[model samples]
Target: ALLDIPCYKILMGCDGKNLQETKDLYNLTDAEQELLESKRRGHALFIIGSKRLHVNFEIPAYKFSYMGKAGGR
Candidate 1:
């Protein structure tokens, strides 16, 4: 499955409060929205190829905060 594959690029430090805004801004599908909504902190995985693909995965909220503090280092 696409979700089972490891992603090449991982997007960190998403603000849960902006889930709706992010969904609206990105035109996320219902599945994506549900995935994002499931956790207070999550990261998005990107598998860019001939077809661009993305999926969200849960992470510790503190990790998200740390990523932000570290400027995504």
Candidate 2:
């Protein structure tokens, strides 16, 4: 499903546990790194190439403080 997008890269960060892997996968943009800041509990996230789209796996409102902090960047 995700492959249909016309992007040069794809990043999947499955919770905080895969931080390094995610960073290695997408080259962690500055804003992206910052988004991972308060995600101590981590989450399943999908970053399509070139900011085309971002999908954070069903996190709760309170836990998504970083999202609000960044104001959807």
Candidate 3:
């Protein structure tokens, strides 16, 4: 059997040797670029889910944050 799943359920992966490459590849916004460039070695993971979106960071200590917008039909 096949289960129907929304595109948001799928996770996309990205990697780079440095923040600049990753920023360029993803075309990050000014704020995002500034955040990534804050540390000497920075990495970030972005995940989108049906109800929310998460941003995981890897720098000095492991950290993560999430945001969701309210909408309805």
TM-score of each: 0.39, 0.35, 0.33
Model 1, range 1-73, lDDT digits (tens) per residue? 4433543544333446677676665566776676555553444534353233555565766766655765566
lDDT agreement with native, every candidate? 0.54, 0.54, 0.43
Tens-digit lDDT string for candidate 3 (1-73): 1212334332224334665565664565665565555542333334244342335544443232222234321
Q: For candidate 2, what is the lDDT?
A: 0.54
Going through the candidates in order, what is the number of backbone clashes in each? 0, 1, 0
TM-score of 1: 0.39
**Model 3 off-target regions past 4 Å?**
1-17, 40-73
- The window of 10 residues in a row where model 3 has the poorest summed lDDT is 64-73
Identify the superior model by lDDT, candidate 1 or candidate 3.
1
Displacement of residue 71 (Cα, Å) in model 3 is 44
